[model samples]
Target: MVLHAVPPTVPRLLTDRSTSEPDREALVVDGVGALTFGSWQRRATGLAERLRQRRVAPGDRVGLRFGAAEWLDFAVAYVAVQRLGAVAVPVSGDAAPAEVAHALADCAATGLVHGGGAPGWTGGWTHATADGDDDTGDGADLSTSDGLAQILYTSGTTARPKGVAATHANVTYGAGARHRPFRHSRHLLHAFSIGTNAAQVMLMTALLAHPAVVTLPQFTPLRFARAITRWSAGTVFVVPAMAMELLAVADGHDLSSVRLLGSAAAPLPGPVAARLAAAFPNATIVNYYTSTEAAPAQTAMTYDPERPDSVGRPIAGGGLRVTDEDGRPCAPGEIGAVWMRSPAPPRTYVGDTTTSGATFQDGWVRMGDVGYVDDDGFLFLVERDGDLVKTGAHRVSTLQVEAAIHEHPEVADAAVVGLPHEVLGVELAAVIVVSGGAALTPPALRAFLAGRLAPHEIPSLVHVVDKLPRNRGGKVDKRSLRRSLT
Candidate 1:
């Protein structure tokens, strides 16, 4: 394998890394298996040949579905599809049959490569196992950097999932051929699902970073803590929900080896970030903000006491701007639409041309989020555009209220949303999961929040549940919550 100064496409990323670091451990999926860079390349090459033999061709869509435990196999299948110049469509192994069918039909997938724990739905597409033997050799010409590489579906918390298509250039951008992505650690651990954008980034990291990527088949606070201790992992990543769970169990684990703790996929509440800082002690807590469509462009903020609420500025060459309803850029501190610009070509929704036009323009991708940029250019997310609570004449940020609610001692988890009301356009409502199942009444909770929040910011109605409803992406499912409340 020949190495380029910078791998221009995803296939070259794998082939070059394998030749350069043949003996290095590339991936370690706990409970499944581990693979060296050389072995990974061989398996991927074999799988690509198999896929070609099955008539998988350039630009053809192929679904690669595997369970969390089978991440190694999933990784191989993903690379193989790219090597054959086919578009890889990855869905979680635990996805519903309906979702699998919908994706296959939507892409008119040519084949499905599955492993243990994959859903049974095939939608009449030819299928094969993700298990590839060690056959070492390259196949037909791989896709160019500008060719469509993959189509990732958004986590549909509010509606049906839409396919977001990306080219090889979009996937390989900023990934260097010679330099390691992370310098502080030799191992990076995360529990992001296989079908998520975060997972794709991690996959790229495994290919380019000096660190060996580590993960569990599934995530539990106890399991996560144990992995850190076992591997002496220096870098760790989690979403806000996972961070909260780790905080609850931090007393039971030895997490002193961690140098960096990153939280992504959602905003890291200030209270949670403060607690995490104390819990990790030596680790620097960082929050990452990005969407599937807007990545590999993102904003990263190292935890700062002064700017606890800001999500930092666009990294390096990326750009972030908040715009008003008409797409005019908003002045600093004015909350409005948030757009992130990537140095690489932008990704767009597949098939939905109207939505694609609205979301992606020029090199900027609209983030579908409501936020403001500080005078210093740090971005502060207020709420999802649709989730902002408008009651009477005021606009209330659900995130602000939720952050305050999280400050309460007895609140374990909570979600705030605007419910329909005859008098007001919408009334603020809250559903909370109390810690230790403590009896928390609506009035008592209101009194607790009175000092911390404005009168209108307080929830007009409150309900206690065992756990807040969440989508597969671990985000609060506001649509389902509203339906249940109404």
Candidate 2:
């Protein structure tokens, strides 16, 4: 059942939940422990007190270093920072010391709290504790009081990761902008690292909607399936990469209670989406799309066999426009640059004005996507940011080629990139990970996509490998793949 409207602040939501159902299970870390709403608050309060003692004043940025397996501690520190009117800068638990240093410096973080996952980070800040008086978490939640609440870093696939500063509303999004407990899914589940935007979504959803949010310390196919069975989770969020793992072992676990399964981060390759749809027959399989900078303006599509490639239209109060290279609007079926506009405050690149200016234009954020809206207004993503391949006179979409490759039943996952070619400027290449050790050849795959893609879209060369290279966020590392193969 739906609860009443929620407070604007993150801490306030926790406070209200504890006030309403102090005994209810608010968070569960599979294989580790569980916390009631009240218990979680005490720890957050304890953390806040420590931060205050360390001179972490309002508007200060506190770096949270935790790995995928340390959600409980990460959760406490994240809220504790907000409790003190400070911005939370989450650094992935597994980040290299150098990477962590860059993120901390980029946000001008004053201190750091580790979950023991950041092995070499030399930054300062005490680990969060939950031993304080019950009144500790009772402090005002200034998350929504104006200044930034979080500075999430984009995956540094190309260069230095940019800090994307988000206000409380920006990070929370408040159950699609409504402040209420959206309990359509009684319990929520996910295995996302704390720093990513998708993980923040799960965090906010747990506070605003799901009664008990269960998370895996680190997402493993077997562990993920077990969490759903053990907690009887009704909703689960996974990136396509994690989704692949879940699909591999879903048969060994009892996942009958799940009612909604969502995928975000990168597009769920067509074959994987289809597999997920079949695996969770009782659930509505959803394909959602969002980025670190472009959020709330996200798109979602319930799996439709007839149009599995479509990422669906923009959410309410938001829309997408496809513009040609010349900055002119494209008609339906015409591919071009995709831009997103949402009602939330526009995002800013913390210290990089040149990149921010090029990305955030007028009121719309350049999604750095190349795709088009269909006749039905559905937005189908062709390629993501910097995911273009210049081939001869054609600019080919790697995603299009990957999707076509994924359509082949023998293929498990695929990544496409452009390689330098003496005659055509750049030629297409594909790295494919086959399903069940299935036999496939570059020539056979090319013939399969012949009807679906243009001559230039098919990979001129294909590498059959055991796996595709993926970055920390579970997205294909096209650049790395290109560099290695070339």
Candidate 3:
């Protein structure tokens, strides 16, 4: 089976032609405003032109710090940099000054595009640059498929945030396979924050596809649901937690227009997936699995009740390998580390090629996740290898506890980890979010897990938190949880 390759001029193909058709609705921000295809092209081109005036030449890096909701601005800046053959580096809007400074210096970014009053930057462009002329040339040479397009900083769940360098071709190809088919006139809604590669891909795909995107400043179930209803959007992408929040608010809202719901960033617990399927009976609920470094929708499990745990088969043009510790293939039902190889994989880490080499080997990227393939070829993730907890003589997968706890009807969310212990070496611990008015205690949780898990696997410590600490990407911040415990 041959993997599909993304073309070198994919970006140009998506943006240039769409921009030429002026009156077409190119983008829409829920509470902000809207932009026509012609306006989007001219503005983005002007931004590129302004960057050139600032001496941001080909190969230079431009740091973008803004909320995810600013899709129009991000699209213009991103395409502008790409048009000039420069790299766009997007960091979270809420990143600390030190983190922002590190990314700017690390990527050797020549200019910065941020929201008004963004902290810690001495000088750069803002929306003021949106009106400049297209000085980068109306018809400049097209960028190579392998040319660096952006550097996305990881969430740093275990260590410092690392810059994942993605090429234009890699993103274009990945987007091609993962992009949900929507017409140019289709209205869409998504939370903004292009810091993560998954979100970036969604933004670019929306722009390239010429769909009118409705950006939400932040995710609030009511606001998001209102936007979908207001715009009559046919599609939307969000994490499982966000979906659950929407379901909670869906009580009084009409969501019949939303036909496609894509869930990613974290595992969509089976219960949540089931609830979403029931609520959006006509919509296709897709649970996707991929990392910031690899891009979106690499693998997905559509709302199929028969295979609730499967993350589905690989998307076209992507390949998966379940390998043992030594990097050999594992047979069906045999657990192993999940590795993926794509034609457009990240070439290197922005500041550290050594670490990049360590992550990518012989063209295959290690996901740092442990799971196995069944005889039917579906992938089931057990837990992140980094999150594995060891206790006494046993290696416990935290996901096992998480899954078991999530199975409880009163539980809304759950995260499991290993806490420092004196006698057991390390003991299992859990932080859970329970439904309102539900009573949850350590002893009660222990009893719930009695027969489902081994005595040792039962969480010895349980804490009920209002909400789990999640980074901008929406994954649980286990590192922060551990720090809080200490």
* Highest lDDT against the true fold, candidate: 1
Residue 422 of model 1: what lDDT?
A: 96
Ranking by TM-score: 1, 2, 3
Residue-pair clashes per prediction, in order, are: 0, 5, 3
lDDT of 3 at 142: 43
How close is every model to the real structure, measured as TM-score?
Answer: 0.96, 0.92, 0.91
lDDT of 1 by residue, 1-486 (tens): 344564378778777778878889999997678989898888888878877888888999888888888889888889889998899999988888888888888888886888855645546555555454688665765778889999999998756899999998889887754457667888899999988899998998888787899999899998999999888899999988888878878997889989999999988888789889999989999999999989989999999989887899999589898999888999999999999998888888888876888788898898988999988999999998766778998999999898888888777778899999999899999998887758888999999999999999999999998877776567888899999999
lDDT of each: 0.86, 0.79, 0.74
Candidate 2 local lDDT, 293-351, one digit each (tens): 88867888998888888888888578789998889999999988889888777677898
What are the RMSDs of all candidates, in order? 1.8, 2.6, 3.4
As a whole number from 0 to 100, the lDDT of residue 350 in candidate 3 is 72
The runs of at least 3 residues in candidate 3 whose Cα sits more than 4 Å from the true structure, single-residue gaps closed, are: 1-6, 9-11, 123-128, 131-142, 174-180, 183-185
lDDT for 164 in candidate 2 is 89
- 452 Cα displacement, candidate 2 (Å): 3.6
Taking all chains together, the TM-score of candidate 1 against the true structure is 0.96
Q: Which stretches of candidate 2 lie over 4 Å from their true place?
A: 1-7, 120-144, 175-184
